[model samples]
Target: MRKWLPLIAVCAGSFLFLLDTTVVTVALPRIGADLSASVGQLQWVPDVYTLVLTVLMLAAGSLADRWGPRRTFLAGLVVFGLASLACGFSPDIGMLIAARGVQAIGGAALAVTGFALLVAHYDGRERGTAISVFFAVNGLGAAVGPLAGGVLTEYFGWSAIFFVNVPLVVLTAVFTVFALGRDTPARRGRFDLAGAAWFALGAASLVHGLTLGGEGRWTSPVTVGALVVSVVAFAAFGFVERRPEPLLDLRLFRDGGFTTLVACAAASTLTFAALVYVSLWLQTGRALGPVAAGLELAPLAVASFLTSTLAGRVLHRFPPRVLLGAGVLLGAAGCLLQLGLAVPAGLAVTGIGVGIAGPATGAAIVAAAPPGRAGMAAGILTTTRQFGQTLGVAVLGIAYQAGGLAPVYVVAAGCGGVTGLLALVPRKQARVTT
Candidate 1:
């Protein structure tokens, strides 16, 4: 019973985290109507969470290492629960966005520590099963989220979507404290504050610039300054990482296989970002209601849940390159199909594509890491994924701002195509080949 408690607690928290990601898309139209949100503000509604989560994720492994997983996990639940309450009660878009930032802090912590706890609890073949279940539950949460959001938002209002988190989080916390016991002995690691600041600022600046430039002209003074800040900050971050005990080991990228796996995480998520655009189009362009839009978009989550479960089981039998390359191409095909207004079919295909790649990439990442650094590796993978999701939203938002939904879909397809090609390039030192 104790053995399974950790997995249960982690999955429950992760489910709530991912549920919010897709669920918000379904509520966007309602939020905009109620608050008179601008396009940029609406984008910020979701992207802000990804931004904070991505930035803080670099330090999540360090926090877990220093404090212990149980403590970190509990802290995340408290923060996330409180933030959800604030979000539900928000009277304006500004307040909701601010609350989302707080939510991201807790989310980043849970994401890193949850995977680390899972790895620590299970080993050998059982470990594989646990990891598979982890990815499967993630897919399932993402699958259920939109429908749940649709129902809640349609019947109870948008606030209901957020308010629902309060009880779920509270229950999860109780189960964790009682069943998971105490944290393990802590590992020592210096937190690289400088490196963390540089990277976060760099990412934020670049995202802000791109989002603004995409809204207007790239030559604007504000856009140009933001771009410059992003470049310098990222360059500084690269330099800082050269020091011993860096927040992230720069050498990890030197491994072609590991890098490819990270790319797979990014690419798969980039495709997932399309659903945001699709949801908006359904509500805004087609004039669909929240529940109607959610029902239409349900196939994406359903496909993801089905394909991810199967992919997790069969991952041991295929090469990462083949699985990821072919899978992402399938997603690219789905994106292309979306050009003709075949939204449900395209989304289902895209879901299948991401589902096939997600578990395989996650497993490969954990398997490829140097011994004793599984937690760090998980943090890096999740960070890369959130970064990709953020970039997708920014890029697609730009396209949408410039030319509307059609252009955004085209750009999304192009991104999927690039990731597909990159996946085929065989990684060096192919460790853990199936």
Candidate 2:
């Protein structure tokens, strides 16, 4: 058996990070009642966390590589735990949203560091095995989230969700420090204020556009202006990345592996995005409760956890393209199946297919990054994935409002199909990507 202690630590971090994202959905109503938040305020409660994490996540990766994963990981744990406590005791919606943003900042550090360290600690087959285990733990958190949230909300109140995170954070931090030891951390030395500012603003503008999209007028002056700003900021970011002593390494983009990595990363999140919509369909349109709604998503979680381990073990001999392609195809099939869901079985099957697809796609991306740049690659992918969620939320919400679920599902299927084709693109092995 693998010396599982280190991996357990990584998995623990993942569980805490993701647990907050999904489990809290069940408690939103309770939270709204307690905080007296408007619908928009309620939406921001989760969106703000996701937004902050996606925007700064790459910076966190840079910090991790410059310093050491161990240090970054531990810092994230402490901050996230404390933030969780703050969130639990939030006196108003604004405070709760602020605390969520801070929690996301800490989560960004842990996420980037965890993936990178696993890449360093495990190699070849073992590496994949470790990542699979890490994600599986996350799947467990998601599976239990609604039940946990419901129970906590029904009994202890919505604050219980935040309170629950406190102990997990402490336990994970203690175990991580013990497992990794007290090595001096690596430092990236200098902060890239220009790069961070430009990138963060770019992401903020883009998400702002999407958030405003729910109100209609995706092309209104505000939305269009935000999009224009995003374009300008990204253009500026490209310039900064090309400079000497750049914050992010652009050379990684030259490698074919990197292309595959980005595409696959996008695919992984897209699959999850579709899953999010399907669950929304079940809960809102069908009026299913949280527990039943979560069960509908369980098949995907199971397939992802199980296949991630299997993919990790077989990745070398099996070409990543084939695996990722097959997985994408499965996801596309599942996504298409999702459109036809009049029954829970249909949703679950689609989720299962997407679950199988995610690990293979992630494996391909992981294979693309060089060891030294692994944290950077993982950070970029995580940010991309998070941003994709916001985009998915916007796009599906718009499509649903404008054309209803059928059109939205059709659009999602088209996206999945397109991504599957990208997966088949004869891409090189995983390597460091900018």
TM-score, candidate 2, is: 0.90
Candidate 1, residue 318: how far the Cα is off, in Å: 1.4
> What number of backbone clashes does candidate 2 have, counting pairs of residues 3 or more apart or in separate chains?
13
Q: Rate the local accuracy (lDDT) of all candidates.
A: 0.81, 0.70
RMSD of each: 2.4, 2.7
Candidate 2 lDDT score at position 315: 55
Q: Which candidate's TM-score is highest? A: 1
Question: How well does model 1 score by local distance difference test?
Answer: 0.81
Off by over 4 Å in 1: 430-434
lDDT of 1 by residue, 1-434 (tens): 66777788888988888787778988988898899998778889888988888888878876776678788888999999999999999999999999999998988888888888887788866666677678778877766677888899999999999899999999999988886767773456577899989999999999889888877768999999999999999999999999976777778777776776677688777665767887788888888888888898788778887787677567777887878887788788788877887877988888888788777777777777656665676788779888988888888887777787888778877877887888888767434321
Task: Report the error of model 1 at residue 1, Å.
Answer: 6.7
Candidate 1 lowest-lDDT run of ten = 425-434
Best by lDDT: 1
**In model 1, what is the error at residue 57, expressed in angstroms?**
0.8
Instruction: State the lDDT of candidate 2 residue by residue for 230-293, as single tens digits.
Output: 9999889988887754556777678765666566555555555454445556667888765666
Q: What value of lDDT does candidate 2 attain over all alpha carbons?
A: 0.70
Off by over 4 Å in 2: 142-144, 184-189, 255-257, 274-280, 430-434
